[model samples]
Target: MTSTTDIKAIIRRHRTRDAAFAVLGMVCLLVCIATLMALLVDLAIDGVGRLSPGFLTSFPSRFPGKAGILSAWVGTILVMLVTALAAVPLGVAAGIYLEEYARKNWLTTIIEINIANLAGVPSIVYGLMALGLFVYQFHLGQSILTAGLTLALLILPIVIIATRESIRAIPGSIREAAYALGATKWQAIKHHVLPYSTGGILTGVIIGLSRAIGESAPLITIGALTFIAFLPPAPVQRTFPFVNFDWLASPFTVMPIQLFNWVSRPQQAFHLNAAAAGLVLMAMTLAMNGIAIYVRYHSRKRIKW
Candidate 1:
């Protein structure tokens, strides 16, 4: 029923809306890219001077000539490894149980809701909890062990959620087939289900660990000392009285904490050091994420079945 002029008007208006939407999207995308580029440029310009062999190897120092992040780097790696160890098994297991074992009951629903809520809770809150339990009540103090455990707790929900999602994405027919083959629940999971979900689980773990490694609020709250020049020594017995868990009582520092300290200082050199440390941390995180992506790509491409 429309005339030629009416049809033209409708078409013109539609084109205008499309154009506006496209422009808006492009503007948003460009803004994000520009922000990333600006930050990288700033970091490189400021931090390149501080990236030296000495910077990588020497322990932390109050004096610029002697300053380095060796201990902080070492402790950070150790804590991250320990955290991964604690988080992966439990997170993956919890995920697998939720996806494969748990029934759709009110109890499971409540647990799931709690986990989601926990993931959203502030990281510092977990640190405070660790402070109360491990530092005050049990007297574990603000040591590497307590810090690692606190981070573990902080990231556990994330890991569990990621793992559950990954496992759930697997087709149910696979499980049904395994069951039809007279496989028990554990056998089906161990032999068939797990192999299928390994890559997904690894990806989730890497992501969780990435988040944990950069976290400073919780670690700081747990009293990770800013200046601990000496490497954490291996536990030794002092047979004067009751046994003490020395690992849980020692002071520690980490990359993010050191970066925070350096950035807050008045000196420009400290600011430079903070940027260099930021670059290193970013590189480490990107490497972990890359590895996860590679695993996912290869695993998906090389399916045996």
Candidate 2:
């Protein structure tokens, strides 16, 4: 019903709106990148000189310049090991069961909904829950085991969600082909499904672990000390068939906790230490993500379907 002039005007208006939106989006992106660059530059300038062997090797000290992150780094690694071991297999298995075996039932729906909801829950909430169940109810005390288990729980939902998405991305025809070759359901899933989805699964693991690594609230909530001065006892005491897990019960402090403690202090040197610790944590996270990306690239290249 519009006249030619009115139609042209409307077109011009639409074009203007679209251009405005495009500019806005670009501006937002640029702002984010600029802020990130500024932060990284500041961190580097503040912390680069502090990233010395002495800082890496020594235990944390009351004196800022003498402080090191050995105990913190070791505890972080140990806790991550426990978290990965506990979460990966169980989460992946649960994802497989939900995707491959679960029917379209109310229970399945409820579980899926709950998992999605849990993913959005605050990390601090997980900390409180861990504090109650693992710390108090289980009487695990403020130890590496309790902290690791809490993180495991915190990241489990992420793993399961990632696994499920990875599995779903595989074409159904692949499963049908495996079945037609006289493979059982379990065999089909084990061989065809898992092989194809390993890339996404690994990516998910890396992401979840990265999230766990940065987390402080849950660890703090579970009573992880911020200024741990000593390393946990070694897992192996004797050389003859040596293996012991007593160290799992030892008190722990991770990089994030250490960094938090440093940042909270009144000393300028402590702030610099925090920055260095931040760099280390950032490096670890980036390394994990890089490995995941490489794995995904190779996996996709090999998997044509």
Candidate 3:
């Protein structure tokens, strides 16, 4: 319907405008990738020299000359694992209950709003909650348990949000099919919906864990001890027995916490150690993210629709 000259003019306009838009988008993406690459390169350059077995095996030292981060490394792992065990299941369960069982009423709406708000609340607030409840009221002291609980509280909203999203992403027809087949809500969710959503849920859990591991403020505010000569043996061997883990009651430090401590010290040795520790922290985090990406990739491949 258009003349050849008109069509060519339209095409020429689109060619210029579309080219500009594409170039803008590509430039933004390239900037982000370049920034990340720079960060990793800097970490490697600063830390590669100090990476060693002795660095990983030594305990907290009175002098920067003699210190290693073994105790802090172990403590970080213990705290993270315990928090994951507690928060992931509870958060996911709460999310499922809200999404599947709760009524569409004002009270439920309020609860959802509150949960969403809590997600945005600063980690320092969780720290205050831990200090008030675990230290002063419950007498758990400034132990690993206290820190884990604080971290759990800080990350619970994230876990719940992720879980709810994963569950919601499951097709409603699947649930309806189970219902039409004489299956109860529990049976449908248990045998079919949950299984289908498990991969997504796990992906969310791992991402939440990744965020939780890098948190330093909440732990510090909740009284994560900066120095501990001995690694916590377990949950029961700790001073606080009521919390189900003894490690919760003792003084402890994590890799991030130790790195922060080292960085604040005014010495070249501490600086080098901090860089090395930062390298370790980044490596662990990158490895976790890599695994999450791989899992998510494989998981998506298995989905039928």
Candidate 4:
């Protein structure tokens, strides 16, 4: 039989180790929170004053005091439009096919492995590929469409993985019940799978877009201009069609590139502009994440399962 002192010693050692780990985890969490708070505070101090209406409406100018993000933000919106339009349908469709329809085989296995690998591929590699495929071979030029397509490619794997995972989370019993009710496979997926997974899919899509928005490396490699004062042609026309597509082929710059331009300038005032632009970017990212969280929460609440 074990002595009472030995049992007490073992218990004391385990408790000591557990407390040490708890303290270590808390320290790491505090360090991360402190660093992020410090950066945000610094940005607010330097840039909050510059976020005025005029700053939003005006275009980039040589004079830092007069410069704004009109073109940058507009370009960002339009490019995001293209990215979503290109990525969502394709990614979702591919995911559905792989997860629901495709037979277990070598080909499917290879495709899955490749997609998982692609998700981790560096962004600059995508830029170079887009430069050759879209710009040279397709003659698309360094335009908004090219930029959008490049980012779409970069995030396609992310969307596909999210789609598959979300769909997989639904119980197989649900699908079987639909089938037992004489529902077609398509009907079951459409009526049940899609609705249940919409929240997760949207979260992934927005998260991917958020990452794409802040990326400057791929855009730069694809020849995005660093300085732009002119807006692309308006996407609405006053004529019979009442819609315009010229903006797709036009030159553009995003907020990150614009901020980079300002930061590169010698003047101290431009640094302030850079800080302001950084603030706006951070706000936009946060807003996207907030929307994702809100949607996910509501969606999960509605799911009885």
Which digits, one per residue and each the tens of the lDDT, describe model 3 over residues 212-240?
88889888887787777787755553454
Give lDDT tens digits, candidate 1, residues 218-296.
Answer: 8888788887788776445556544445654568899999999889899987898899888888888889999989988
**Tens digit per residue, CA lDDT, model 4, 150-242:** 999999998999899889989999999999999999999999899889998998898888888898889999999988889999999899699
lDDT of 4: 0.93
Clashes of 3: 6
Looking at model 1, residue 80 earns an lDDT score of 83
TM-score of each: 0.90, 0.93, 0.86, 0.93
For model 1, the run of ten residues with the poorest summed lDDT:
240-249
**lDDT per prediction?**
0.85, 0.93, 0.84, 0.93
Span of ten consecutive residues with least summed lDDT in model 3: 235-244
What TM-score would you give candidate 1 relative to the actual structure?
0.90
Candidate 2 displacement at residue 182 in angstroms: 3.2
| lDDT of candidate model 3 versus the reference | 0.84
